[model samples]
Target: MPLVRIHLDTDRTTARRVLQLHREGRIHHESREAARDQALRQGRTPAGDPVFVGITNGRRDVQLLYDVEVYTDATR
Candidate 1:
């Protein structure tokens, strides 16, 4: 299993929205899953996707960090 950590430079509001959406089950799984889907859809690996992870309020941007681990076999 490889552990992947993604750091998103976002504001507080965005992070809150992500948490809310995840809690509401409006999307499948965690925000990390959504991020992975979005990354993969864009032809990129979820482990190395460049994204913003936070909310921007005025001159401040509160960013959130995410850690995702994927278990895989030797074949993968």
Candidate 2:
């Protein structure tokens, strides 16, 4: 199963909560809908702050690299 990396514009607290859930194996590698459901249960806002950032096509390492690139580019 592919990994779903959800990026959020919310505060660190909320983002950390969601990341923790993912790391703890609570959120399975299912559809995006499943992730959204888990995130909601985990206290993520449904408005727009905590939104789907990106999805990895079974390339977790590459996803990290891409994220770093995007972040670096955005900082410029």
Candidate 3:
């Protein structure tokens, strides 16, 4: 997917540059499902498609990607 980086500009040149950067893996990405799951947990979905997400990082500062149970040494 070609994501628009409005921070640069909305022109076609900027769009092309963003695409190039994305192809070079310079763009950061996260799971849409993760975002959706986190949003849904807050009682609303985002403006895009809905999807099921696993234990992705909700607490960005903690740098943890699993459930709290896993972090607390609880067995699944």
Candidate 4:
């Protein structure tokens, strides 16, 4: 499946929150830009610590695309 990577500002809390929302099905979109725009609209601003929101088939792609740490070791 194609993936969408959403770039976010530096904020661990907000980043995780957005990710959580996506995982929980609160946020659903097929495109990266759409997800990013929706995230921003939901209050995840691109300010200090930049984070990335990604929609992918798995977490590995998300980690690579966003250069963010993820807990996928168990899956591997």
Q: How high is each candidate's TM-score?
A: 0.43, 0.28, 0.26, 0.30
Candidate 1 lDDT, 18-68, residue by residue in tens: 767656655324555565654455444444433333333446755455544
Residue 52 of model 2, lDDT score: 37
Q: TM-score winner among the candidates?
A: 1
Clashing pairs in 1: 10-54, 10-55, 11-54, 11-55, 11-56, 12-55
lDDT of 2 at 73: 18
Tens-place lDDT digits, model 2, residues 1-76: 1222443233444444545666675542333345455445544433322233433334233221101111211211
Pairs clashing within candidate 4: 8-51, 9-49, 9-50, 10-49, 10-50
Q: What is the lDDT of candidate 4?
A: 0.39
Candidates sorted by lDDT, descending order?
1, 4, 2, 3
| lDDT value, residue 61 of candidate 1 | 53
Q: Of the pair 3 and 4, which is ahead by lDDT?
A: 4
lDDT digits (tens) for residues 1-76 of candidate 3:
2111111113444344445555675632343344445544544424444322122223332121211111222222
The TM-score of predicted model 1 comes to 0.43
Local accuracy of candidate 4 as per-residue lDDT tens digits, 4-75: 244433344444555776678663222334444544554444332223345233333332123222223222
Which segments of model 3 are wrong by more than 4 Å?
A: 1-30, 49-76
Candidate No. with top lDDT:
1
lDDT of each: 0.50, 0.36, 0.32, 0.39
